[model samples]
Each structure stands twice: as C-alpha cells, then as structure tokens.
Target chain A: MSIEIVNVSKRFGDFVALDSVSVSIPSGQLTALLGPSGGGKSTLLRIIAGLETADSGRIEIEGVDATKLSPQKRNVGFVFQHYAAFKHLSVARNVAFGLEIRKRPKDEIRERVHELLNLVHLSQFADRLPSQLSGGQRQRMALARALAVQPTVLLLDEPFGALDAKVRKELRDWLRRLHDEVHVTTVFVTHDQEEALEVADEIVVINEGRVEQIGSPDELYDSPANDFVMRFLGPVTELGDRLVRPHDLQLLTGGGEPDAVPGRITRITRVGFEIRVVVAVGEQLVTVTLTRNEFLSLGLQVGSEVQVRIAPEVGAVVGQPRLLGAV
Target chain B: MASHPSTRTRRGPVTYLVRLLVIAYLFLLVAWPVYLVGKNTFADGMDNINGILEDPDIVHAITLTVQVAIIAVIINTLFGVGISLLLVRYDFPGKRLLSALLDMPLSVSPIVVGLALVLVYGGRTGWFGPGLESMGFQVIFATPGIVLATVFVALPLVIREVVPVLEEVGEEQEQAARSLGANAWQTFRRITLPSIKWGVVYGVVLSLARSLGEFGAVKVVSGNVLGQTRTATLVVEEKYLNFDKGGAYATAFLLALVAVACIIIVSVIRPKEDR
Candidate 1:
C-alpha cells in the first residue's frame, strides 16, 4: 500500500518536529528517510504509522484518509532502532505476538512463528529471550516479528543502528534482499548516507523538519535539488556559480599556464580504491579523486603544484544559497 | 593490579571505622530486635503460640488482616500500573503536580491519612458520608473505612516501584505493538505488562507488607471492634494492653515471620530481575 503524507505538521510544545512535510511513498519499494539527527524523519515515519498524530495535516494510506485511525487499524509493521522485542517473551512468542493479538488459530500462529524464525535465521533461538541474543540477532528477531503480521506497510527506524559497522553492513544487505523477496512498502530512517544509497529505491533527505529533496540515490548525487542535498550526500566543491562533486574535477600533471586553473596541492590521501588530492585554488579548497593508475601516472604528492579543470558536463547549478559550508 | 600510593592513602583508618560503625548500628537496631522476638516467642515450649492460635478473636484478627492485605494488593496493582503508565508515558499540564501528589501517601503520616479519610467519609458531618449512608453504604468505623485508610497509607509503594521500570523500558515496544495491529489493551498486555512484571511484583509485595503491618491508620478507622475490626497488629496491641505477654510475643512473631518471608521473596525475585 502506498502512503501519502500531505502537509503533515507536528509540534512538541514550542519545538516543531515536523513542518508541512509531504511525501508520497510508492508501494513495493524500499525508501529511506535519510537525515541528520533531530531532522524530523522519524516523526514523519511515526505519523505515517499512526503511532503519532500530526498537529495539522492528513495522512492517506492506499488513498484512504487514515489520519483519525488508530495505529492498531493502520496495519503497518514498525521495527524500532533498539530491537523492542518483548524482554520477557521467548523469541518465538515475540514473533507470534501480532498473530496472537489478531486471534489467529494456535496452529497458524505456530506455523507463522516458525516460518519467520527460519526467515530471519533464528530458528535455534526460538526459546531464548531477547536479552540472550546479540544486538544484530535481536534486530533480526524484531524484523521477523514485524513481518509476521504480513503488514500492508513496513516502517523501520534505524533498524541496524545499534549494531557495529560490520554487522550493520551485513544487515543492510540482508534487509535489501529481504525486501526484494517480500516487496512490502518499506520506509526506513537513517542518518547514514551509504546505507540509504545502497538499500533504498528512493532517498528522502530531510533537514529542520522539512523535506530537503527526495529522489533515487543516483539522481540525488548527480543532480541535487539544492546545496543542502549536495553537501549532505557527499563532498561538493563550488566553482564560481555552480556545484561539482569531488570526482567530477580532473587534475592535470603539468602546471600549465593560461589554460587550466593553477592550484597548490595541500594533501594527498589514498582512500580504498581511489586517491583523494586536496588542492588550494586561491581561497577555495578543491578536492579531486583519481584512480591508482592515474595517481601513479600524475605523480601527485603533497606540496606539489597542479592544474585543475572542471569537466564540461559535471556542473549542476545549486537551486538555493548554501546553508552550510563544505565539510 | 597496581595500587596507587594516593589511593592507598585515601583509604585510611576512618573508612574501616565507618564500616565498623555501620555494622554495629545494624546489629543493634535490626538483628538484636529480631533475635529477641524469635527467642521470646519460642520461649515457654510453644504454649503461648498455641493459646494465641486457639483464641477466636486472634484467629479472626489474622483472617481480617490477610483479607484486607489481599484486597489492597489487588486494588493497588490495578491502579498502580495504570497510574504509573500515565505518569511515565504521557505529557500533560500539571503532570509534575500529579507526580508530586503520588508521593503524598509516602510523606504523610499514616495517622494523618486515617484522619483525612475520616474527614472525607466518616459520618453525616463528613464531606460524602451522609450521601453514602443514604445509598446504604457505611465507610467510617467499618471495614470499608479501615480499607480506605489502609489504601491511602499504602498507595504510593506500587507506583513508586513500577515507574522507574516503565521509564527504563520506554514506549518503543508499545509503539511497535501498536504498529503491528495490536490495540491499546493488547499492546499493554503483550508488551508493557511483561516488561514491567517484576516491578509490579516488587510493588505489590511491598504494598502487601505495608498493608499487613499497618497499625496506625487501621487503629483510627477500625475503632478496635473485637472480632470485626481488630487486625493482627491491633490484636498484638490489645494483647499487650491486657498484659498477656506470651500472646503479644506470639502474634508479633507471626507478623515478623510474614514480613521476613516477603523480604526473602523480594530478594529472590530481585537478583533474577537484574539478570
């Protein structure tokens, strides 16, 4: 089921949590609400789930007005950042909770519970409490529990946020694969840009309780709607009036006169498969990335003077004034 | 492990002296009384205990105390869980004021609580007593009056114990249950209830102990009606007044035994909860 959050606004006393935030999430797609902390992405997700009520707007689920409906009638599965598994319940019973509350037959509940445990690869931990499992395992169990009800929509608030980096990556890939298999309308919130880029079909970047921009990962990176989205996704360099990514800038070996912009190299750092070269052009610092072979051929090093050239097709005019400086 | 010279110097004879003082204080205040009571009750070859058990008034007092304790526990558990949930989960105007009001029972003296209940529900002169009596209900100088006073005295114990656990567990699980098609009541039963089960147990046990041991409040409301209003504590006081030393010791021994049992249960349940 598609979720349409229209002009939704919520406030906590004097603080605004969401302000006229509207977004249309398509069915059967994994979307990510990507933003910094305190950006109201979680509030929007909670509003859609009916776990929170908006102060001044409406939400429609499957084209039906769902603003007044309680969360129980919304049929949306929510996985919290901190597992939220029932601490006193066995893993199996936790997964069976939704079905049990719906008054499903005992046999059906057991079957679904077993099926979910197997799906999350926690069959052996069926009898174990949530505290017995690792952070990643608990989140997996939480996911299984959320999916047990076969909800119309699935909402996950930083589902792998508490896990370490390695476990987080593994779960991200696993969640992507799981979404492919289940294909429920899924919306997950995270501040991790890499996670949103890797897993989501669409990324909704939020800032200060408003939607900065929403688009596919490549679309957001290549042609950001504004300076905030550009700076938020990855490194951006300003060239007079236009915005360009670090990768879009090319560095020539020779300090050519009159044709290329002359810049003094300040730092050269090798990061994984690419080499980053920070060059100073006047007061602005430009970052350029090159392949290992290209760096070797250019013989680029710190304290070296180089010529910088912005590619012809790389420039995208930033729609708004820069809200933040380049990081 | 290497011990720093500064740390070693910090732990002087004063620390050891303080530890000894605490030990001596506890031994004198708690252990000495318990030992004396145990020795006195069992002193005279069980004759005192047997006579106290055979007395109908004593037996009736024990039954009444147990009945009131059980009823108080049930009522407190329901309202305690509900009120604690309200305090922890929701934000509202005067929330701090309501929270402060919850501590009234804990701070106010039990005798004062009895007087307040009497003022509210005693007789035709009371605030609601005449209307209640017209509706065929008697509160003051009756079992209901005794229970009201006891409830007022013991009301804060359960709420105090349960609120911290509810705050620690948070509203995420309840929100998750709601999203999973569980209604408010279902969410409370499946998620909230289980998470706060140990807290509720500790609270109810505490309330039970307080209710059973209550004398000051029950004294004012019960009017010490023999066989009807005389609770276990009241019987002990009565036995003392009558100069029946053996009977008083035996009843006090029984009350102490039950209180000790409650402490033991709490200790057992607490360590498991920590895990």
Candidate 2:
C-alpha cells in the first residue's frame, strides 16, 4: 500500500501554503520530508494525515481515494511535533485509547497496551501521567500511542524537534529500528538535514510546498544533483570552481610549492580526532583536514605558506546554483 | 503600570505618585468591600449588641436563599457546559451568532432577564402561561420562578470561562484521537473532554457564586411572599422597612456569610490555568 499525493495545493485565505506539490510515498519504507520553516513540509504531512485538506488534488492509499476522507477514515497514525498525548491520561491509558476507540476487546486492549509500552521502553512509567514524563519519554509514549492503532501509514511532524541533541540522536535510531520491525509505511518531517540523512531510507527535500529532490543519502552525497545537496550533506572544502571532502587535500613535504595548488596557511584548529587547517588563496580561506602529527610536522603558524592539492576528477563536482526556494 | 528601576534607584515624582494612587484605588475599590463583608459578618459581642447574629427568621431566610442558588447553579452547570462544548467543537450555520448570544445574559440587566423570563412563562399572560398552568405548573410567583430567575442571572459565566480554553486547545488533539479510529463520541469523551475539564470546573464555580447572590432578577420575578418567595435579601429589606435595623443587619449578615463561603469555595476550585 503506497500513498499517492497528486497535484496537491492548499491556500489559506490570501496566502498560498502549498503550490502544486506532488509526491508518492511507497509502503514499508521510511521517508523524510526535509524543509525549512514555512516551506510547507508540515503542511503536506497534515494533508496526508487528513488533519488539513488540500484545496485541489487527489490523495490515495493503496489505490483507494482518500481525498475527501476524514482523519478517522484515513487510518493513518500521526505523532505530532509536541507529543500530543492526553495530559490527563496515564501512559498505559493513553496507549490503550486508540484500541478502546476502535472497540477492541478489553482483554485485547490490555495486552496491546502493554506490548506497545514495552516496544517504546516506557512500560515502567505506564502508570504516570504525560505531564510527569520527560520530553523523550513523552515522545516515546506518543509513538506508542500511535502504534497501538495498527495503522497502515505513520506520519510524524518534527518528532525530535523538542528533544535535546543526544536524546534526538537516540530516538532517531530507535525510530529506524521500530520502522524495521513494524514494516509500516512511515513518513516523518524534519528540518535537521543530519537526521534526514541518518534515519530516512529516502529523503524528499521539500521547499515551499514543492519537491526539490528525492534520493538515498549516499546517492545524493556521492553524486549530488546540485550544490544545495552537497553543502547540506556534510562540511565541504571549496577550491577552484570545485568542492571536495576536507580529507582529500594533503600537505606537501618540500618547502617549495608541490606540483599542486599552493597557498599560505591561514589558521588551524583541533576537531575531534583530526585537526583542520585553513589555507588562504587570495581572498578565499580553503579548509583541509590533517592528523595531529602531520599538523605538528608542518609546524606552520598563521600566515605560513603551504602547498595543497585535491583530485577534482575523483570527488564531487560543482553542481547547479541553489534555488532560492529549495529549502 | 510603570516599573521603577528598583528601591535604590532614582525615581520620578510622577511615577511614584501614579503607583501609590493605583494601589490606593485598588485597596478602596476592591479590597475594602471584601474587608467590610468579612469584618461586619465576624463582629464580636460588642458589635453583636446590635443583634446582627440572633434572628431565627433571618437564619431561615439565608437557608432558603442558598437552597435556591444551589438548584440554579446545578442546572446552569449542565446547560452551560453542554452549550459551551457545542459552540467550541461544532461548525454549523449561525454558530457565531449563537456563541455571541451566550453573553446576552451577562450584558442584559438582571431585572430585564427576570422580566423576559416572566413574559415567557409568567402564567398571567405569558407565552407558556395557559399551557403550563393547565398542567398545574406554578412557574410565576413560585419557587420555580425564583430558580428560573437565578438561572437566567448565572448562565453566561460558565460559558465565558470554558469557551476561550476550548479555543486554545483547538481541533488538534480531537482530530488526533479520531484519526486513531475513534468514533465521534469516543473522540469527544476521550480527547475533547479531558482537555476542557479544568475550564468546565472553573466555569461551574463562577456560575455558583453568581447564582448565590442573584437579587435583582430574583426579586422581580419571585412573588415575594413572606417566608416563601422572600429570600434573605427580601427578609433584610422587610426588616429595614419596619425600622428593625438590628434584625435587618442580622439577616444581611447571615446572607453575606453564606455568599462569602460560596465565593471562597468557588475561588479555591477555579481552574489554576485561568484559561
């Protein structure tokens, strides 16, 4: 069962929120909707969830038209950005609510609630209210609550936005594992490019309600369609009309310029296991990565002349200009 | 209100004067009435020499007043919360107009409220007069009339309190619940209900307080028969008219004490979120 969003558009009074956006979300794969704020990423998710309707378009799940379907009939689970669990209900009750609403057998609901709670690793805190849970725990509870319904599709809007960095990373991995075991059609939205790269099987980069590009992280990173994809994927080292990985450049051995690009050392700083060295060519400050021993051997202070070279044919090419609306 | 830098900072004379004047105005306008109600009701033996605590009729009148208020409040709680949910959750034609009309009770004079109800069910020439009285309904100049008047005076407070909170909650959580395959009623019971429970509680409390002290409307409609439609306020008026100042004071004191108690209880249970 796949979701087909065809020529979807939305207008709010005077402002057009989405303009002729279309995407197909295949079943059993995790898709990330990446965009900047007001880029209509969340709006598209809401349309899929049927929280908001498109002004003109067709939405279908598994060949069944869902264009006019209410949210309840859409049969899609949504985890909101702000962990919209029932604040008054305990975690167990919150998870059980979906089942209860579906009129599942009481015993079945009890079993499912426990199972979902265990899935999210929140079984211990199942009796506590949502207000009492930390942000991470609340998000897990919301996910568990969404999962309880056995929905065919799961949509999340900025699921990790409220979480701290470490927790965000942990939950991103957790979501990937959950998606694997459940094997459900899942679509999640996030502005964090790293998160989209790490968690999503295919990232659909959206900009102002339109799709910019859609591909796997490695495919996009190794062969970027444009400069936006390259800079967005990882830190870059830009040289003459070309961008290369920082690690591609090596320091020269001799005092004279090696048969390569030559420039004066502008700055150096330690980063994690490696040190980054900046070389100035005219007005440009090109960055290169080096080991501690290599940096020490060079013994170059600020403004010391140095030689650097990058194999342009091997790495990424300078791609298209970034479209203004390509969030 | 201007915020001066600090106690140690330099201050303008105008700023200082404005702050002092506002404080005094609040103290006089709001605090002093509360203070008088508390003081007069709790006066000692020397103050009680005026017989402000010893009249059995006044005591009985206060009891009747409270009974009517409680009935009015309970009925209002049900209607107000129901109507508020309807206004906040549903989208129907004239919904905006219906919502705006909820505040008609608050805007209309209490005496006008009583007259309007009397015109509808007055039993003399009212809209429902013949039909109701033929079925043995003693609505006008009766206990039901008093309750109807109090209810008319108290209906809007609850709606005002509950509506804004419902607006803030929006349709998000309810839509979320329904999307989980919850039936419409189940969605409302589970999602919409809990979200607005605090707001409902606060609205009901305020409704109770206003119902307890409803005088103008109740006076106009309740055919003031002594010891019957004669509520605590009417008893005080009767005593004062007879030149029984001490007895009037006693009756007024009893009524004030009960009203104060209801107010305190409501204030305590008002929604902490204040929305």
DockQ for each model: 0.82, 0.60
Clashing pairs in 2: none
**Each prediction's whole-model lDDT (CA):** 0.88, 0.81
lDDT (10s digit) by residue, model 2, range A42-132: 9999999888889999999878899999888888999998888887789999899888877789999999999998899998998998888
Error of 2 at A30 (Å): 1.6
lDDT for B196 (candidate 2): 80
- What are the per-residue Cα lDDT tens digits for candidate 1 across B116-161? 8888887777899988999999988888888888888889899999
Best by DockQ: 1
Give residue A195's error in model 1 in angstroms.
Answer: 1.0
lDDT of 2 by residue, B1-275 (tens): 15644645657797799899999999999788766755654465445424643556555567778888889878887888789889977778999898778778889999998888889998879999668999998888888988988888788887887788888888767877877888778887878877888777777667766776677888888888776777877876777899866566656655566656766876786666543
Report candidate 2's fraction of native contacts.
Answer: 0.80
Q: Which stretches of candidate 2 lie over 4 Å from their true place?
A: A237-262, A290-310, A313-315, A320-327, B1-79, B82-109, B112-152, B163-172, B221-232, B244-254, B264-275
lDDT of 2 at B212: 66
Q: Candidate 2 chain B — worst ten consecutive residues by lDDT sum?
A: B44-53
Candidate 1 residue pairs in backbone clash: none
Docking class of 1: high
